[model samples]
Target: MRFLVITLIVHRPDPVTGITPSARDRLREVVDSAVLAEELGFDGFGVGERHERPFISSSPPVVLSHLAARTSRIRLFTAVTTLSLLDPVRAYEDYATLDNLSDGRLELIIGKGNGTAQRELFNVTPEDQWDRNAESYELFRQIWRQDTITAQPRYRPALHEAEVWPRPYQQPIRVWHGSATSRESVDLAARYGDPLFSANVTNPIEPYAELVHYYRQRWAEYGHDPALAAVGAGTAGFHVAPRSQDAVAAYAPVFAGQLAFQRSMGMEPVFPTLEDFIERSSALIGSPQQIIDKVHRYHEQFGHSVLHLHAEAGGLPPAEHRASLELFQSEVAPALRRTIPDPPWPWAPVLPEAAVTAAAD
Candidate 1:
């Protein structure tokens, strides 16, 4: 299985210690984590976008551009770029520039995004967000494929064979649709034969598994190859130690912090207690063997070849968090990598000889 480390750049005070890093420090941590992920040999590192309070990931392109400069070979990803709230033309321009800056190592995961504050901030409503997402993606894909395209869209001004500057470095970059119990996103992903990435952090396996199955079903209906349908899944959290008890004990405060943060936000959590959270949620907190077993269980349901772990050092101490990640690479990853089949990585384009000559001339 291919593994990615992702962070949403949540800027909240530590629930356990009542300490919050300065915004600058918080962002520095994210950059540092991406570097660490590369050092630890992760396949990719992703940053999420959220235009709301407590989340400073409003500009993933800027953040990813920096990450691209810091590391080579590790694929850079947007955990879920908020297409519904963005102008497709602008979005494509930023990512295209980033793709060039990253040496064509950029991949995208697009979603409508959530949260009332962010939706309000972007002037996107639940009723029309899906339509906006679909429309934006249609235009965005056209921009990526064609040199110039004429088009009209409801959410943005019409394009009359408009050519966006700094053409893509990659002929076509891979885009994964991010879904969370949303058939609109799933159907869109299947219709286009793009990969589906399940936001599996919230609830149990049943909902996510059902969505994955439906994505596969739709993939067949759309005349796409069943073998080409790729899926990736996200985890609620990640912490591992030599012993299950030790891992659980260390993660308990983190769990408590999560519940506190939820309640503080006036949202009730599905798992009120740490034990329930571990029992049902996708959080990987246990010994290495137990973590591997849990992943196998999840893989049986989702058939996802890609898995993402949280990159930030949430409530855990920096030393322990680093140790857990190191241990995972040393132990858990090898075992899972041996058994789980991975989806094909995105193709990096090679310029034609004619194009190379034209550029030189």
Candidate 2:
């Protein structure tokens, strides 16, 4: 595993402390976290897009563009851009612009977003979301590959001989389809020969493993190389401490509080009880050795090259949150890297270190 630190930019009262950071503070924290991730030798940093309450990351491109100006080596990603809700033409233009701004270090993981509130916000029904995602992705891919094209879709107008400017630095920028227990998402990724990213945060291993297996099967059916099947997985949470006991003692209450809040809001947590949560959920809240073992088990199931962790959640305090990241980078992440290979397309164009150093000055 190539480790990625992902954040939802969650803005809510901490179930433990009842404190939330200000919007200004949150923005500063995001920039600080990106910089720290690069310094800590993390391969990627991603921001999630959520249009509903308790989430502030509505504009991932804007946030990523800012981080691009500040970091040189860390790859930037969108955890999952809701392709079903946005116009493909607009997304293509903006991401292509971001590609240039970041010196070509951009990877998109597209998905039909979760949360009923988000669907209502975009006036998209659950039944129609998948179709929208398929249509939008088809147009988005075409927009990147073709210079001028005509597209006629129900959601968007026809573009006759239309051209989008400032093409991306990488010809056909890398994209991964984010799949969450949806065969449609898996099939779409397979048909396109793109990578599949499993949302393993909210479910048991069997469902996600089946989807990954399905993705590989479909890849072969689509005449793609089975050996080249690329898959990524997301972890629920991460924390590291000197000892397993110390780690659990500190995190268990926080975890339970967060779960209770989710339950109170009518959401179903994958793990109901605190004990089951620690044992079953993908959350890696323990010592470095424990975390490494857990990741190894998951690797056997998913065969994922990329593994992402949501280290901060439920409005944890900045000091506590940063400490967890510090410990993880110092102790756990390096071990995982030794086990998994780098991204297949590591040679993708990106800004040079000298350019970023000079820009900072």
Candidate 3:
């Protein structure tokens, strides 16, 4: 399986000390984390986009572009680009440039983002969100594939034989549809034969599993090859120590802090306690063996080939956070890599040509 480390760049206070980093410090941490992910041999590193409070990830393209300059080999991803609130033309322009800058290492996970705050900022109603997501994606696909495109979309201004500059370094960049409690996203992914990425963080496995099942059913119904159906899943949290008991002890406070934050936001958590969250949700808080077992269990249900773990510890100390990631790399990843097979993607970007060209330039 392909493994990824993702961060939402949430700017929250340290749970133990109640100290929050400055915006610049937070962004620097994100960059440092991406660098660490590559050094530790992660397949990809993702940055989330959230145009709201307590999040410094409102501009993923800019952040990812900076990462592109500092790292090589590790693919850069937008965890879920909020397509519903964006103009496809502008989004295409920025990502196309990023694709070139990253030497075709850009992969997008698109979704109609949640939360009423962003929707209000974009002047999008709840009723039109799905439609906006679908429409924007269709147009975005056209912009990447065709050189000259003439089109009219209900949500965005018309494109009349317009040419978007900086053609993607990869002919057709890979796009994974992000699904979170929505069949519309699943249907859209199935209809286009694109991959589906389940946001398996908020709820239990049942809901996300049902959606994956639905996606597969639709993929078959749409006459796409079953072998080509690619699915990715996300974990709520992660912390692996030498012993399971030690991991539990270390992460308990982090979990309590997270719950407190959720409660403050008036959001009821599905997993009430830390133990419950570890048992029921995708939080991999235990020894490496336990994490592997949990992944195998979920893989049986979702048939996912790609898995993403949180890069940031909710409120753990930097030393503990780094140690967890180190443990994952040294212990957990090797086992999982051997056990699980990677999905068959149509193509991967050829970096040699782009690298040579940039050097010459």
Q: List the candidate 2 regions with Cα displacement exceeding 4 Å.
A: 311-320, 350-361
Question: How would you encode candidate 1's per-residue C-alpha lDDT over 1-361 as one tens digit per residue?
Answer: 8899999999999878989899999999999999999999899999999998899999999999999999987999998999999999999999999998997889999999999999998888889999999999999999998999999789899999799978988777889999997799999999999999999999999999999999999999999989999999999989999999999999988888889899988998998888888889999999999999999999999999999999978989988999999999999999999999889654333443555688799
Backbone clash total for model 2 is: 0
Model 3 residue 65 CA deviation in Å: 0.3
Clashes in model 3: which pairs?
none
The prediction achieving the highest lDDT against the true structure is: 1
Name the candidate, 2 or 3, with the larger lDDT value: 3
Per-prediction TM-score: 0.96, 0.92, 0.96
Q: How many pairs collide in each candidate, listed in order?
A: 0, 0, 0
1 versus 3: better lDDT goes to? 1
Give a tens-digit lDDT track for model 2, residues 151-178: 8887889889999886776676788999
lDDT, residue 183, candidate 1: 93
Candidate lDDT scores, in order, read 0.92, 0.84, 0.92
State each model's C-alpha RMSD to the native.
2.3, 3.7, 2.3
> What local lDDT does model 1 show for residue 145?
87
Q: In model 2, how large is the Cα lDDT of residue 263?
A: 88
